[model samples]
Target: MPSTDSSEAPNEASTDASTAPWDVHRLPRADGKTFLVTGGNAGIGYFVAEQLAATGATVVLGSRDADKADAAAASIRSRVPDARVRQIRLDLADLASLKASAEALRTDRLDAVVHNAGVKFDQPPRRETGDGHEAMFGINHLGHFALTHWLAPLLAAAPEGRVVTTGSFAATSERLDLDDLESSQDYRPDRTYGRSKLAQMLFGFELDRRLRAAGNTVRSVVTHPGGALDSLTPPRPPLHAPTTGERLRGLPAGILVQGKEAAAWSAVRAVLDPSVSGGQLWAPRIFGLRGTPRLRPVRGHLADAEVAARLWSASRDLTGVEPEFGLG
Candidate 1:
């Protein structure tokens, strides 16, 4: 766990999640705001959607499966009777699908877009996308890269637009090389996933720099769900139907891990907290693995400006999505 000492934490404290002791339930009213959450059908993403909807935000769940998305949205409505929520089919593994999804959202003003969809690991031989790129790299980083580009116009048009990409603790421990982003030479599931997440962190920071330089109103922020588990999460059919093995696994993690809802505090804060700014990274307050959300310092490769710029260029080339800044 990372230390929460003021000296160690990054960025100064602004506003708490709510007026009452950093509680997520008391989030500011989001009436009339619209947020799109990728992978909202499951895990931390689903809880993110639920939390936003509870606060009067119009939540759009981006799921690869329409049925699963519908189920998640229905679950949200069931919990929050007045919750305005819907689902859109978005397969992160497919670039074509991502583009189309972005187009579908063109007419909507997106207050925030949470890039939360991701694959934890790839099995032996590794899966590839339609573009023949590694699954984790393509879906986690490249796919979101293109989607954000397509939606840049909509984001910029909003009063306070935000792009919150999900990051991971793996970034601090694992190695990465922007030169070989797809991991053609070195292919391991854990390392590949870590590199992809590092890329995401880089993209978030680089994006902020570009947006600032271009004088754009949109903000780019990054967040990580620290040690969250399904067994600890509220039951949402299709997404959080914990198995026997999963329950067994959760017993120990339940002690060491935070619930998905708790983990989502970082993302929710990133999107809705007026005090939070672009380029900041949010994570658990206690060692970055558990407790309330807080502004955390970014270190190592994730903080390298030159490397981040290079990664940004590589992303643009790989995804073929031109940067949209200061444009109508």
Candidate 2:
């Protein structure tokens, strides 16, 4: 059995002041490393890709649309000048295409993959993916699950590979209905979306456990960008161009919430912070809504080992792909 004790992992409080609070603007250089950011074409994912690219790492923007992905890459290059950015066509909703998408990366080693892509519907008649699963749960959780399985080999090949799963603060209030993983029975927009993110968080923790049990070098860490709003986000030209009026409208909310760029901090820290360990949850420092990314204890259902294990099993059965982490 994998040891459940987390005592051996470095505690955030124990780290020296110099590195305890990470500077999002001045990330550690990752000259030769490569990272993939799913849904990098827009929103928080785009900023994550841009920040990673600034570190001199080859950042790949994984998106369903080639045009959008290319535009995002170009935007990053515009900002970073000499940024080494690439794009791969990735549609998490279509599970059948993920194997080929992973293969298309064509890299021997992948230092990290930030699973940032997700779908949420505010008003819906309830949608399902091509795989006949609920859209939000399908793309948000199972899609990344299958992608991770296919990318396991490349991740295992890295010196200190990391799988950074982007979760959500909304998940805190939600619980998984293990019997109805598809949400076909109790489908509400917010509830279903929260449950999907909860599922992703569970998968992250369980993946870490399995990696430890198998003695794999790869690590899985989970992070959530708390309360990010587009109106507060700075424009990225063709990608995101919030108007002056929009910024003014969002000013009141800015005190409690943050822009998408600020929201990317937790995931960025999870990827680049050497002190961050597997099975940890990172979030914003202020009310978990807006501030610097900080290490936070996994509480409530997020730490429920039994649920995580069951979810892992269910994910395997649903996706038809066992994440062996190269152990097989």
Candidate 3:
């Protein structure tokens, strides 16, 4: 096993705080590392899975749709030639679905788990997932939350155990609803999505705190693809591409990603960057909110230990995925 925990500092030269975060030439991942990416069938999630495979890591694609998962694995193998990516069935919307996925995968080792699958939309009427939670919070946040809690052991077993959950720029828009999580009264799609994202990010902070408190070595970190991203958006979104995506299709402009290929770097860096010291977040660094990926500083709100603990307790109560390492 590798000697360093996820929170440990890397080799001296790798600690260059001055380096830009979003370089396309990704740093090589550790040999024999394994990663599982949720919603790896298409969009940014697919791109992240593809790049990780290209970096010589075995990747497991977790998607709700089995057929789509098969197709996605085929597409990636075609592109990367020797890609070692597999597919697993994981439905975030249903409790039984999530439980079945966990039960089926009895594997005890995973270096990293990236929670990149989520939904964002503008629906006329409100909807809830099979679990009776609001659409955005249920599927986007709770689904992944439950899944991650189940996978915690596999992550902790790895030499540099890490979990990277994807947050959105939307998280910047709204604060969490400690009082009313589901927004049962005022169910606005946009706000719900933002709240869910906030939930995911907050979960990362809480996970880190719990790991530390329990004397566990697992490291928890979060990453966002940026405002204008092709790779990280949900596969089912109506606006998968930027409305003006065609206009931005010219040459590799200054800091923006021209395509999904370029955008996957932000996530790749988060998983493998030896310099990343746990709590620091990663995202693209440029205007139009797309392009140069960097390990930008995250908002302090995420680091609020009080809010993190509250969110953690709420999540466990809601999903019932009892984490092995208890913080309280």
Index of the highest-lDDT prediction:
2
Could you tell me how far off, in angstroms, the CA of residue 214 lies in candidate 1 after the best superposition? 1.8
TM-score of each: 0.92, 0.95, 0.84
Error of 1 at 250 (Å): 2.5
TM-score of 2: 0.95
Steric clash pairs (candidate 2) = none
Ranking 1 against 3 by TM-score, winner: 1
lDDT tens per residue, model 2, 110-159: 99999999999988789999899999999999999999999999999998
| Ranked candidates (lDDT, high to low) | 2, 1, 3
Worst lDDT run of 10 residues, candidate 1, spans 10-19
* C-alpha-based local distance difference test score of model 1: 0.83
lDDT of 2: 0.90
Model 1 per-residue lDDT tens digits across residues 191-244: 899888888888888889888887888999999988887677766665577777
Quote the lDDT for 127 in model 3: 84
Q: How many backbone clashes does candidate 3 have?
A: 8
After the best TM-score superposition of candidate 3, give how far the Cα of residue 49 lies from its true spot, in angstroms: 0.4
Better of 2 and 3 by lDDT: 2
